[model samples]
Target: AQSVAQPEDQVNVAEGNPLTVKCTYSVSGNPYLFWYVQYPNRGLQFLLKYITGDNLVKGSYGFEAEFNKSQTSFHLKKPSALVSDSALYFCAVRDTKTGFQKLVFGTGTRLLVSP
Candidate 1:
């Protein structure tokens, strides 16, 4: 079985400061990882993904993630965080070994960027 873990329940940061949300994953075979952000009363928005290729993957809203194979981690990062970036973030893993590409998601990590 595959699983994702967001160790921190919440990450507090001041506006304009750099921020990071941690995520680690477990899988039987090669892992397909993804990050999603959700705003109040809104669906999850795609942030970034790591299927294969470069160790560092960039995504929307000045966000990027480094895929660390050794640590089995894909932590989301931003040089500067905005108040608008405050939201609930999720880390997911797609189990390609199964017929259906079901995504296993972590509990969630809430980001609070204060002005």
Candidate 2:
């Protein structure tokens, strides 16, 4: 079985400051980690992914995440936060044992970026 954990329920950051949303996972095999954002009443939007390659992966809207195999973590980061970035973020891991058929998502983290 595969699972994800997002310890914080919410993250607050001032506009223009840096931001990070942490995520940890457990899986049977090499994990396929991903980050997604959801605005109010909208579907999940893909942020970034760590399938294979560099430990550091960049994605939409200036967001990035570092995949740490030993730590089993894929933490999302942005150099400069924006008010528009305020949204619900989720960390997900593909159930590799299922051959990428399923994704187990974390209990979302709400990012509150204030101006």
**Per-residue C-alpha lDDT of model 2 across residues 16-89, encoded as one tens digit per residue:** 99999999999887888999999999999999999999999999999999999899889999999999999999
* Residue 55 in candidate 1, Cα distance off native in Å: 0.6
User: What lDDT does the true structure give each of the candidates?
Assistant: 0.95, 0.95
**Model 1 pairs whose backbones collide:** none
Instruction: Please report, as a residue range, the 10-residue window in candidate 1 with the lowest summed lDDT.
Output: 95-104
Worst lDDT 10-window in candidate 2? 94-103
Instruction: Name the runs in model 2 displaced over 4 angstroms.
Output: none
TM-score to native of every candidate shown: 0.97, 0.97
- Score candidate 2 by TM-score against the native: 0.97
Q: In model 1, state the lDDT of residue 25.
A: 93
RMSD of 2: 0.8
Residue runs of model 1 more than 4 Å from their true location after superposition: none
